[model samples]
Target chain A: MNNHVILDVQNLKKYFQVGKNLTLKAVDDVSFQLHEGETLGLVGESGCGKTTCGRTCLGLYSRTDGKVLYKGQDVHLMKGAEKFAFKKEAQMIFQDPYASLNPRMTVSDIVAEGIDIHKLAANKKERDEKIFHYLNLVGLNKEHANRFVHEFSGGQRQRIGIARALAVEPKFMVLDEPISALDVSIQAQIVNLLIKLQKEMGLTYLFVAHDLSMVKHISDRVAVMYLGSMVEITTSEELYENPLHPYTKALLSAIPIPDPDVELQREQTRIKLEGDVPSPINPAPGCRFKGRCKYAKAICSEQTPQLKDMGNGHCVACHLYNQ
Target chain B: MSKLLEVKNLRVSYHTYAGEVQSVRGVTFDVEEGEAIAIVGESGCGKSVTAKSIMGLIKTPPGEIKAGSEILYRGENILNYDKKQMSHYRGGESAIIFQDALAALNPTMTVGKQIVENLMMHRKTIMVDGKEVKLTKRLAMQEAVKMLKMVGIPNAEQRAKQYPHEYSGGMRQRAMIAIAFACQPKLLIADEPTTALDVTIQAQIMDLIKDLQKQLNTSVILITHDLGVVANVAKRIVVMYSGNIVERGNARDIFYHPKHPYTCALLEAVPRLDLKNKQELASIEGTPPDLLAPPKGCPFSTRCKYCMEICCEQAPAATDFGDGHEAACWLHHPLAPKDDVPFKTEVRHE
Candidate 1:
């Protein structure tokens, strides 16, 4: 969307020790760049480390290796005042609205939490005005200011969460499946609000979700991850129209289109992925998806494939596409 | 076609401190033999309540099914069935599988044992040499493993010996399906069976359900809020809103020619994958109405764009669109405004 790079993630890896001899590679060898004022969608199935990647990029989780740079400043290396400024500049909107916000606190206080932490407002009068402004921005009224989290519905609570993130006036946001917990009718409402807010504020987004349709609609570029590794990254149109990776094709085929006619045509051509995603703990070498891949050969299980650009800025990591 | 199950004027309400919440108000539909129909609606729209009412899971202390309600199973009214008769009808004649497979399954019992228990309750005896004998546990366990393998769970013997937590989300759902079909019931109610799994796993489970339905020839009623999911699986679709059936038709009819504004709005609200460019989603403006004192007219009138004055005054009766398709909306009335639909809906006759 822009020439300026807002966030650059380089070979980021985040691991956890599950047992005495087991290590879970949640985010391994994942790298991407988020341009200024652009929404980059990170999509994968559950437990594929999309959420872990987003959190690691936001410096929420300590990385095991590599660096996350926000506007050329390393996010993990920053300490004291620099880290506080980075927090104010980049906010995270969590997945569960019911758990993200404090249930006992009023809506105004919940929205003002970021404002208070960043000292964006000086006095009580200024804080109230800022809170009301953000409330109205996210389509809430003044009457909801004093109401607790339990009094609102799931959609309204998600709006409250968005308002809290907007209160800090962040230039970038990491939305971790913000609409997954919401109902279908309510999901479009939040997506529309996010689109409008990004247009009005010129905010960059690192949208992490498993919903491919929503990702295709809202993102300028899309990245596909599998078993804690990015398999493909390209423009949204190119990625959806011509997916080069085998896992990406399978993931796209799995999504059920809401029309019977389309489903009738797709049923025969659909790729049925067998079994579940392999456990990420102490994973084997070579391609992580080789176990389920149809075109996996001897070379796929022997060596890991790196992301290779296939002209026009489209990158894919797969042994089948090796040239 | 014979009707496998008929729900007539089913009125279910919950008495709370505030008022009586009409969870399912006079819902009526029929599941023909060997047919697959989906009940699609948003959360709090009473789809789950209707399923629960049919299953007789409503607790009477705070919940009540009003008089004049009838749930006919194989031409008999099950609402009047006694405890022993009801228990016999529950797993023996009809079965239900829930959304959360982990919670619906027992944590302490092995997967095989659960299936064995269901089989023992429903299928107590088998005929051998023209004589009925009591089913042994060993025989039931063998049948349970066979049922597990039938649902596509590999290594069935070893997996059956493990508990529910040991199985993954899709596998647990498969085990649940195995138990539900073990009795060979006439009707199966799958309530959001794949809602907890991801898209890939969801596709696998949906395929499994489709295969099993054909194999057992059992009528299925799928309840879920996602319209995208029901398209491929359900033969007919029932669109519900605020405890009322706004529209019901064959899958193609509903997708091509949606009569009610709520159904049309739901179709346009979800973003489509086939569309290439970024487009504005036509989302509904407001939330569903509170069911405590339900609206007198159409429940979707508050959010409908073509809301006539008469719509707020009284509820519209079901207007038939032929071929067993019907929708309850004022727009279809002859005296109402003509050509009021904002979107051009194609009506293709096959």
Candidate 2:
């Protein structure tokens, strides 16, 4: 991990109108920074707006407020050549392999889509060479190039997706739950492939996933989201070992340990959250997790807690540490 | 404990245009009166087929349960049951819950109505107001509210009246569990029940299921691909691969002293949060075998690090270690060389 910040997201918000008067707060006041060659994991439950945050950061969805600075330039304000260069500098690997790629397109065309759009290759041979190079980089061979997308398995299709993302030679990539849809054995394979590629290409990643163990394994830092708001952010080790927020503690404790011995010997109190997450539409001005938190007090419902920096760069947005 | 359900020599095949796809082959297992047995494997390993066969849920013509298979439930062969008898056994004696609660539930009707219908189908009479009465819709609705509250659904009276689409994901799953357990079935089969929920919600649902199982003494057969879930909830685990049972053991034995190479690879592949040192996950080399024309030998032979000549020549028999732990691998054979431990990928240095 380097000190150079590749992407700086400040107070980003994305809202959707569900009805005539309702506003669904998808990504509200989320902020983070992705350093060069560093993997920053964004973790939350299904409706926690982690994916929306990632999409908003990558300019896939226009931000309702705040700014997304990609190397000190506002992504929302870029135009013409600057926008094209930004597209080349940033890419995304989608979550679903089955739905992301077109079944009619061959693997070669899919991998070369970015290359063709950017016209990185001077001749047909150079394009073919680049396609084969990315395929090999993602553990696929030149033989797999001519085959259609439907002919490949889930893991193979994901590799094709990676190859497509890498074909652009992007400096920053947003991988939105890249391995969540895969099987366990295949998940490790994909993770290893990503690690190998990151090391070789010096790519920075904003990996969004629901799997905590996988996030801890691959990320230098992690941020926990709940109901469209970031609850905690810190180094992966410190976040896992000494989580500050009650929601993070509950989430970490809820993860089932694979070892029987550890599971059997675990005597810690299970922080069972009481109710489901409150609806994000017209949410109250308070902690989003207050309804389910065990230690919530009167002040928690009166005002929203801000993400405050503790020592050693650990940050938490909870009323427990307000003093 | 007496056996509640026993499946013997169970072979199921699907007929397609290409050939007969052997989805499940000679699967044998038994669930004790109150035991929780988990059948764990990746997709297409036939764990779901086995679970569906137990409930007589497999669709024939395209799929068929082969001859000489016996599915004995409570000392009676349910495989030969007629339609009416099968229906009676399905919800009254045994029930299955699915992962996707919305898909499994009736969307048009209120959740309470669904539970009441199930209860009325399985139950004949209920005691109401200190008198024995024929189970009426009103009485059944009362019971449904009780069931809803039992599953930890808050505001059960109001929530029970809403349709399935109105409830959240975790709540819908809880409602499904309430419906499944409404009949008080002797056996419950949960097919990846928590796979669709978040971790915290998954933990809550698992705890609820365990509590209900203990309270009702209902035998459970949990089919999942997650070994971590199995370790935490299940007592006995049967690891399957390409329609074959590769290993069966108690949770402790399976996790700590795995015998099969596939099991070892699976254990090593999972990233553990308890470990102090972070290391790269060691994954198995290839995908599961294609069931259309599965290998004549061991199904995992193609990816086994300990693959030998005989592994491809013939299928290995299940070698029983003590305490009901068994593994089907050439390494466990008596004639195989000793000191040949199952190999795992080396931990990464950097």
| Candidate number of the best lDDT | 1
- Model 2 reproduced share of reference interface contacts: 0.70
What are the chain A TM-scores for all the models, listed individually? 0.99, 0.98
lDDT of 2 by residue, B181-287 (tens): 99899999999999988998888888889999999999999999999887877899999999999999898888878888999999888888878677678988788
Q: Please, what is the whole-model Cα lDDT of each candidate in the order they appear?
A: 0.92, 0.91
User: Where does model 2 exceed 4 Å of error?
Assistant: B129-131, B343-350
Cα lDDT tens digits, model 2, A163-237, are: 999999999899999998899999999999888889989999999999999999999999999999999999999
Total backbone clashes of candidate 1, pairs 3 or more residues apart or in separate chains: 0
Q: What DockQ results do all the predictions give, each relative to the true complex?
A: 0.86, 0.78
Weakest lDDT window of 10 consecutive positions for candidate 2 chain A: A266-275
In candidate 1, what are the lDDT values of residues B1-350, reduced to their tens digit? Answer: 79989999999999999989999989999999999999999999998888888888999969999999999998999899999999999998899999999999999999999999998887879554678878889888888998899999989999989999998888999999999998899899999998889999999999998998898889999999999999988999999999999999999878888888988889988888887657789889889999998888989999999999999999999988777778998888777776758533333244
Q: Estimate each model's TM-score.
A: 0.98, 0.98
Q: List the pairs of residues colliding in candidate 1.
A: none
RMSD of each candidate relative to the true structure: 1.6, 3.1
